[model samples]
Target: MLKGHDFLITVKAPGKLYIAGEYAVVETGFPAILVALNQFVTVTVKESGDYGSIYSQQYRENSLLWKREGNHMVFDNRDNPFHYILSAIKLTETYAQEIGKKMKCYHLRIDSDLDSPDGKKYGLGSSAAVTVATVKALCHFYNLPMTKSRLFKLAAIAHLDIQGNGSLGDIAASVYGGWIAYNSFDRNWLKKARHRYSLTALIDRKWPQLNVELLTPPKELSLLIGWTGSPASTSHLVDAVGLKKAEQVKNYQKFLHDSRACLKRMIKGFQTKSLATIKEEIRRNRKLLQSLGVLSDVQIETPLLHALCETAEKFGGASKTSGAGGGDCGIVLINDSSNTQALLANWKEVGIEPLDLHVHRVND
Candidate 1:
């Protein structure tokens, strides 16, 4: 018989922002810079009466019941808002079973600050954060000694299972925290491996092919995040961009070459504390994105996004739409924070909400 009440465990993971090398990160498998924002998704697990239940404060779901079927965990409700959570629980439970451990029944409460006060997701990688947090909480609850790398791989697998695409850069930032320079692992290789081995089997072994490096931003640099009040579907945008690339293969390849070079310079700028180099790379990046938008006839950047960048530029800052960025959050990198108020005021006047976010770590 399992104990009805035992212990409570909570885990929090930070959201992420892709600072540079967005579209190309998926295609070229090059290094993409990502920062873990202070915004976090938190999961708390505690003992329950009978079966387990979940309450998602972010999604406003009162109570959701989940059960274990053989070696797998399954959500009792379909079309629920806890896709990531459900997937995470299933994976964690499976891992525990494979390692000859049993998990007790418990209630989990999930919440997030990645949304606005009114509950609008601000394009922060909330899904990835939630996945990481859930896995961490599960491991903690079951007394599993999962290393950070193993946790990352589990979270990445859950994330990939849902979205079916992505470079897992967001997952890396959430798992490792702080800032990271991530080179995309070969999706083809991962696909083949997944078919050949179980997730637990893969976690037991190390893959020399995975590449993730930490990068420190310049001390003089200030990063400001601004929400556009409009949401963009990253998958849709990525798919559209992919279609455009297929249509204009040669041009897209040339653009990728330039973007790759620009990202390298941007990385170097961070290391050397060269603000001018960073700004130039950012400018080239936006120009290339704009060129892609024009060629594909897609909405890469909105009018307000451009206006925010221009306003920031007036204050000796460089801004660009971060991530898939038709309308979501834009990143503003400032060398001089002397006039941050002015830049923020200009952005506010144009209906952009400047989010107060910064680099964050899991344990800090």
Candidate 2:
């Protein structure tokens, strides 16, 4: 089964951009739509001597020597940048042991195209992508059968171990490429279930309310992305909103209801292949997020993001901040009849750099 002389195995997971339904998606059973971008985090595993090393191109201190102590990974240095990768390795290896697979030391290397040239994050869900890529690469190395569902569950478990908050929608998009309508599973349920069930039993069980459905965008619909050159911490923003959510319970409930209804209509737009309806709901979703920001006292839409949306509107494209959005990327939806060049020009004038990214399909 080992084809290469070096016994190398490589896997790449695509980064994701939220199309609609941001904050609300964090709640169990709430829905969000996202697309996997062409950019990716690639993980390569190769046979090593006795101990394994991890090298990442994105970090200044790139290499870390790790050895296995029973099931635990003992790192040479505690100052490490690979929390998500380490989590993935630990969880995947735990599952391997559950299924009677032999484990061996292997060198893992990571390369990412999800950030800017100078190592600035572009809000493309790099952590989720890297986690998925690491889990996928290790599964292959262990000769484990990895279905899409299994991959998503293992990756989600690994990511949630590090992140501790937010919907795992990014993991879904990374696992199942292209456009997807995702409903978050109940994290509370998983937290309790993990104590009751083993890793193998949990992977074999159905996660409550978690759903991932591939979506087909209308042929006439065109997507545009613009980077504001500022990266936001998703965990910090989510925590901020969570703190306010309890104080304004009525307002938070209203926001959730509105988001669910709006996303339903948008999903219908996709089902009917109506580009106009999809764009209309995108504008509506933007307004909802603005109200949410006002209620939560979080600046979800920065000035640069506001300018980005306004410029897109002037050019006949519906736009909004993509994710948690303290300052990151904004997404725009246009049609074949729209003026694409004018939009790019106006975006640049406002200091918004248009990114040349496309939807990445798994088969592609």
Candidate 3:
């Protein structure tokens, strides 16, 4: 049933950056904005004779041999670095079975441009991009049709099974590609649904409170990103906030309300193409995140991050840390492109490295 050794399929999924809504977006129905970047994780699948191999350019040491064991994948190495890829394979193959598609052995290779050449993470959601790429590659290999929504659900399921937290906005950005406004679905409902429904059945049903809308940013809007040269673990920061939520129940509620309001105004800015409204909300959101850090006793913004924001403010741009930031990138929104060169100069003077990334839009 092999197509031939020459048969090959490749798929690439773009990395994502959070534009707004960090800590609060983890809760169900909370809104956030994100953009897909041109940087991507690419997966290539080649038809194999009998056994299969999985390799990663970034994790060369973790390459291993695998074979099919009666509808299940059996790996030769236990301590492999391809957890997200393996999960994607298993889930997609399971869905393939439900659709009566035959499974075949193949050699899978992964390559990523999501990190620096020296292997430093830029907080660009590499894991999510890789997972999405794996699922997409397998779907193409199996001749399965994948709509954006279906791809998102399959990838989200695989990702949630592994890391088990966060808003999955990165996954959405990878699948949908471009500027998106996302509201997270109820994870508790999803946890229960997994027990009652098959993978195929679950993906077909609508997820509660989940929403993803493509946004068209104003033509005059100029977005600038500056990296602080330090990687922060999103899971760690989110976990810290989770632990403090019970103690600060009322404060958490207020933060959620304020975040929702702020996001609504920003979304309106996007709709009306009002750069001023967007900038004001960005500044407001920054203050809210600072307050959140104090309330949760977590250091969301590092000293370098503060400098990143202050420098942007001084250059006439509204800015804040992009993601769950103890350290990582900061984003600035400005209408005047003239200030960009000066801002980048000042950012470099203050130890911030300006990253040349732009919003990526996918062709349908």
**Candidate No. with top TM-score:** 2
lDDT of 1 by residue, 65-165 (tens): 57688999875432233787888899898888878786688999988898788866688888888889888888888887688889998888887777677
User: Candidate 1: deviation at residue 272, Å?
Assistant: 1.9
Please identify which of the two predictions, 2 or 3, would achieve the higher lDDT against the true structure.
Answer: 2
Model 2 TM-score, 2 decimals: 0.93
Task: List, residue by residue over 1-364, the lDDT tens digit for candidate 2.
Answer: 1133467998889999999999999999999999999999988999888999999868755556577999999764322338889999999999999999988999999899999998788999998999999999898889887889999999999999877898999999999999999999999999999999999889889999999999999999999999999988888789899999999999999999999999999999999999999999999999999999999999999999999999999888999999999999999999978889998998899899999999999762
Top-lDDT structure, candidate number: 2
Q: Which residues of candidate 1, in runs, are more than 4 Å off?
A: 1-6, 61-81, 204-209
Which segments of model 2 are wrong by more than 4 Å? 1-5, 62-81
Worst 10 residues of 2 by lDDT: 74-83
TM-score of each: 0.90, 0.93, 0.93
Model 3 TM-score is 0.93
Which has the higher TM-score value, candidate number 1 or candidate number 2? 2
The residue-by-residue lDDT of candidate 3 on 75-134, one tens digit each, is 543223388888999999999999999889999999999888887789999889989999
Task: Flag clash pairs in model 2.
Answer: none
Q: lDDT per model, in order?
A: 0.81, 0.91, 0.88
Cα lDDT, model 3, residue 93: 96
